[model samples]
Target: MPRYLDRDRLALLAALVAPLAVAVVLLTFRAGLPNTSIALILVVIVVAVAANGNRLAGGLAALSAAVWFDFFFTQPYQRFAVTKSVDIQTAVLLLVVGLAVSQLAARARRLQVVAITDADYLARIHDTAELAQSAKEPDTVVDHVTAQLTTLLHLRGCRFEYGSLIGHPPRLEPDGTVVWGRKRWDVDRLGLPNREIELRTFGNGRFYGRFMLDPTPGTIPPLQARLVAVTLADQTGAAFGTVGSG
Candidate 1:
């Protein structure tokens, strides 16, 4: 999610604007349109807002529409006071319908996002397995690992650390370390923003090496990063085993 305002926040603002726009257009012919017809039209606008936004946004839109309708369309115009029971019914119905529609739309959007995420994860898993299979040598395996990780974690760059301790990879830490090249990775130092990470590769019950990575900002949450790190370590461990076995 963005640090600034998102679609939902904007929707709230839109809800406020929709009524004023509608009031301008509809009030022009307020004398010609029946109260019931105008009420139904306002309800339609509220429903649309709710469908495109969250529950709170929808509720706000409905309330605004009802308030405007009462002021401009009902008797005792330009006032908060309502005279007819029918007008009361109209406002209540509009608000109730808007809230209901917003709830349904919000649920649908959440499910849709989940479905897409699931599909993408499956694809990534398949690719990881395929890359692991094709890698025969340690360098090739390490290269593949780095590339896959860079893409998976939305990293800026990732490179394998091959040294004498290649067979003694570091243990996984709850708080992962960050690295970028030989110099310490820092936006202030590198003149740009980056999330650098260091993850060890342990395969076939022995350590292979570690990969230094710089991730894209705000892509993976802590829990998800740990999950990805574990998977990568498992794959790397398997590849290390294969290199020796071959």
Candidate 2:
């Protein structure tokens, strides 16, 4: 069985049957011949299936219409066999055209959906980057990072730990080391197999404490990871200014 059919059999069935039902109603109750109305109804069915995010459903709808058209609309009503040559040719042409139209429309709809999803992702990333850049205080930055990470990646929690190199490394207390600068990554380590996104600011051959993200597996793609790294680096550079420049 096809994946789409397996995933959405009921929707596929509805897409296939609704147009035929409309055509039957048109033939039985409304008038003698459906004329252009039948074709319009079939087009509507294709559009509806495409709108529902199943391009295969559109093709299925077209196939169902061909079968229904031959059985009901063609001469010698309620029969699979067609007597007239022109009617047979017309049915074949209708089937071919409907299938082609549905396929093309479905492809366009799929592309549109992808474009919208990508646009939304970009917008959210941009907003997060802006918020990160605008944060002046350490606590504020940590809060923003935690909130954004939770919203963007749906993580359980986020905490940053500044290393010894940044400004001031956290001191080791009597029981454990008290890290002042480094954001805590202990919670992140609890989640298995996570990607650590590290962003660094380099000046005078020295690296500043950078932003880090522990992302869930398969949630962040390579290209997106690279982009986030670049954005964070840019934001850190803007915050600290050029340390070595004359």
Candidate 3:
């Protein structure tokens, strides 16, 4: 969404404009324009739209291209009703090619976006680790980790609580679905606001300290976020290695 037009609106405009542009191109070579040429042109349009992550617009462009082919290029010129079997086949092929190309292009675009998103997560984790490494005190490390975790998980609040933490056995849900108490977070109550996820900083069965995150509603913390939290907690614990528990 930009200042001028949102993504959906831009897609809609592309859907309407792209097919018309292709039709104009077809009109220039109306005669002797092979059925293959029309199909190729329409496919190019569909792919262009779909590559922009606008599959709905690509589908609309595909349909329009099919209609334009029948109306302008077929024997029944200026009409959608195609009489010749060959023309009918060309029209059908044009539509199928557009749709197929659009599907493939859209899937590629989605995968590209996912790849970029994962890269961002990695970059954030790396930066946060570097920041934590430079921190001198346990509280400073905890504050930095809390800030990073809050932003990463879209949580409401997060902080470190120092105390003797009770160890719980690692277990799964009653339904045997998702892991619940990984460290000390309840997974059964997923999507519930104010849910706290506390990970212990201590390693080797020693009680050091704990960091807690209050997840915002509607956010089921991803696995990467959990891993990062656990790692941050460990780093914080190491910084407070010899300090007395709060």
- Model 1 residue pairs with clashes: 202-237, 203-237
lDDT of candidate 3 over 1-246, digit per residue (tens): 574347656766887788878787778887777875676666677667766746787788778888877888887688769898877876776675566445545655654532112434434443444444445555776777778778876889877677745554232221222334544344436542355655567744566666666768877755444444554555466556634334
C-alpha displacement of 203 in model 2, angstroms? 58
Off by over 4 Å in 3: 1-5, 113-246
Top-scoring candidate (TM-score): 3
- Ranking, TM-score, top scorer first: 3, 1, 2
Clash count of each predicted structure:
2, 11, 0
- TM value for model 2: 0.39
Q: Taking the tens digit of each residue's C-alpha lDDT, what string does model 2 give over 31-136?
A: 5555334644555565566546465776787678777777877778889988887567556645554554454445445434321113333334334344443455
Task: Give, for candidate 2, the lowest lDDT window spanning 10 residues.
Answer: 170-179
Q: Rate the local accuracy (lDDT) of all candidates.
A: 0.59, 0.49, 0.61
Q: What are the TM-scores, per candidate, against the unseen true structure? A: 0.42, 0.39, 0.43
For model 2, state the Cα shift of residue 120 in Å: 32
Candidate 1's displacement at residue 212, Å, is 59
